[model samples]
Target: MGPGETGLNYMQQLNQIVYPGIGKTTNDNDCFVKSRSIFFNGTTDFEQSIEEEMHRYQLIWENGYFLKTLKEISHILNGENYDWELDIDSKTKNTRSNYIKDAIITKFSKAPNFQNLLKEAYNKDLRNAITHTQYNLIQGGVVLTNIKGDNHQPFYGITFEKWEEIYSKAWFLLRYIFSGLKDIMELFMFHLRKKQSQVESPFSYQMVKNGSKHMHTILKEGTGGLFINEIALTISYISIFEI
Candidate 1:
């Protein structure tokens, strides 16, 4: 991760796919809900500005985590030379990393839906709109504008609904990759056991399957439901006070 890799070019290719609370406890599962609360509550001359700033910061942090995990997954897929005298002769060297090219997201773009989502959900153009301040909060949605064409004729505008759609799609794609990384880790542990001639493994494939399935359900469904629940809670609280 270089200092300026947060640039739009890098963000859309892989950085935009992030799972909000994938690793939190049940009692701590309020991050997305709380983030939505920012939209429901409060008003100030600087409120929109503040919200946008937070969005940028959060996106940056999310990419930081996303890229880091991707790298580790690359490592697992691309095993390293342990030079373990204990290791089997066939295990003297590893090549997945070489093939993966350091697990950069673009390397895996040959897959079917991947390139499409990367381009549509978190493309370079859209990232520039958010990162470069060429946007507006209009009608309760973020409006992204591009004025690049001659006479600014072929300009582009991305509305808030589209952004939300991108967010949802990005969530599923990113989490699917993360699930792969987790599965790889479990496989690593199993390999270590087999290398030791141990017939039993500490890993549970069923547990991993269940976890992965639950993640799919949540990212695909829970994102919106959490916001709706939060909005309702906020409304109920307000109504109680008013009544």
Candidate 2:
């Protein structure tokens, strides 16, 4: 559910329980609930400006919560202890053991079908540029100033089109992880209801090579269900009705 829908449901439940006889003021209560729910729904703009997209992307990247969440999800998928820590060198272990970028690189590099997706979605150069405030907006592109190759090039420029592509990949990756978490939770509940000691997922992850791009696809065991594909990412969920 979206934020607004979830909030509205909560308010309805709260009213039914907390104020069972508030029907005389139902209109007032509902109007307040609906109005406040819109705030949780956030902006209605479907097509945001480039600056706005960059601002949102920078916020997610800088906060780094998604990176940690992704790692935790990977741990769950691998049937590992959730608290398992990635091994680090002594220096890093003593200082910044869970550094976001380093942890992401280490964890996904070893993940079976996720290595290429990481490369596609997580651009170290773009990340450095955004985090360090070393990028500039140009006429039709962005110039990244925090990048240096073996040739020691001072700056790198990415066209607006390229920027959109990269941003889309990152956005889709975020959505995929979110969807996967919800799906996993539902699957866990199903497992408990079925009283199964162990359950094998009907879904499997596959890396499909599409010319120059690698697509990460989550496929179910059967056909005739819904499938949503977003660029290089695909996430599958079992409908509650089906469960």
Candidate 3:
């Protein structure tokens, strides 16, 4: 299937996974959950739908795997393997790279075409407007009031059509990264299974899936359980120990 189709399928499957308090607020006594919060829905209101779409795009742009994948790819390209995070700048060393734009322009300069894709996907001005709450909803689109043009003069915001284009590019980049990582993970798992077959081990892993796998803190325990709270899934495991 095409990438779009594959992405759609993946999203559909992801949406199907049931979580407690999903589409609802979790409190002692009150909550409401709606899938529309996560995805743009069949709302009749055009402006509202556009607003929701913009918010969704902004959310992903800030917290998505796209940036993380970029850092990991940069590390591999630089041929430095460490258990720790990367220090892109030694002068002011940080685990995270502060020079994200440099990562695209300078680090990945060898691949001009891919660089273009990254550049197209990332719009610092637009993100700034969204992040800093410097925009307003117009008849057809929101105006980034602070964003200026080549002459360094403030211009009107992008059209709804333009915003849609930007959002699509960003979404495509996300799916592309996800697909690549999935392949790598599958290959790694295959190798892991192969290695396991060649070893005789006393250790046995027991996975108990109560629901969707989430990492919860195993605070008061001899054994540890990883809870992936972001996905709201619960998977508990017991490791066989010779006790």
Candidate 4:
């Protein structure tokens, strides 16, 4: 559900226990017991935001994979067309890896990374540690420990505000990709159809010599919305990657 709806649901459940004559609770004591019961429903205890925290974690990796997939598709569509700024006499052999990096820098104006998302949700050093190692559940929240770092320092806990920022970014990025992928699909289909129309036999001579006249019809739907919220939300999530 959306954030507003989710907040409403949370309040409704809380009120169901807090308000009198709702469910099996009719007083403060009953309310407290019902709330605790729900907290431990089918389990020893239920921690809040754990599911959302995990979702944010998975999205960080998945977002990186998403960007990689976009580069691959661009390569398939346009081939290795990266514009290198090296001197003409420079003999650096061009490779797919170099081409992908160049293409992303040229098109997206940045290197592909998920580091910002992870760092937004957690302390940067703690994020690096958790990414490499494991985290444990604690009373208030998850504790990320590094034997080398935390042994000399204190553990870092992912903050609620940062988690919200990460989650906001995840939704923003997914929608951004959704809009872009749809536009690309339309462009690809137009090219495919144009190619098919050019294949003429005796039964079907060149009735449509040029596809330029139909270009508007083919790409009309691709003038999609570049929503402002997409950028605003995404900037908060990946601000670190701007460098």
Best by TM-score: 3
Mark the 10 consecutive residues where model 2 has the least summed lDDT: 232-241
Cα misplacement distance, residue 92 of candidate 2 (Å): 9.9
- TM-scores for the candidates: 0.42, 0.49, 0.53, 0.37
Superior by TM-score: candidate 1 or candidate 3: 3
| Candidate 3: C-alpha lDDT | 0.47
Instruction: Report the C-alpha displacement of residue 159, candidate 3, in angstroms.
Output: 2.4
lDDT of 1 at 110: 36
Q: Of the candidates numbered 1 and 4, which has the greater lDDT value?
A: 1
Q: Which ten residues in a row have the lowest lDDT in candidate 4?
A: 212-221
Q: Write the per-residue lDDT of candidate 4 for residues 1-243, one digit (tens) a residue.
A: 022332343444333322322112133534332443343322432333444335444433323334343443333333332121222112213433243235433444343354343234333343344455566544434456653344655666654334445555544454455456555556655754654454432121122323411111111123332222222222233322344
Give the per-residue lDDT digits (tens) of candidate 1, residues 153-208.
55555544465566555555566654654554566546444443432222222213
Query: Which sections of candidate 4 miss by over 4 Å?
Result: 1-48, 59-67, 70-133, 137-141, 147-152, 187-243
Residue range 190-222, candidate 2, lDDT tens digits = 644453233333343554343333333333323
Tell me the deviation in Å of residue 111 in model 2.
Answer: 3.9
- Any residue pairs clashing in model 4, and if so which? none
In candidate 3, where is summed lDDT lowest over 10 consecutive residues?
234-243
The TM-score of candidate 2 is: 0.49
Off by over 4 Å in 3: 1-44, 64-66, 86-98, 148-154, 195-243
RMSD (Cα, Å) for all candidates, in order, is 18.8, 17.1, 16.1, 15.7
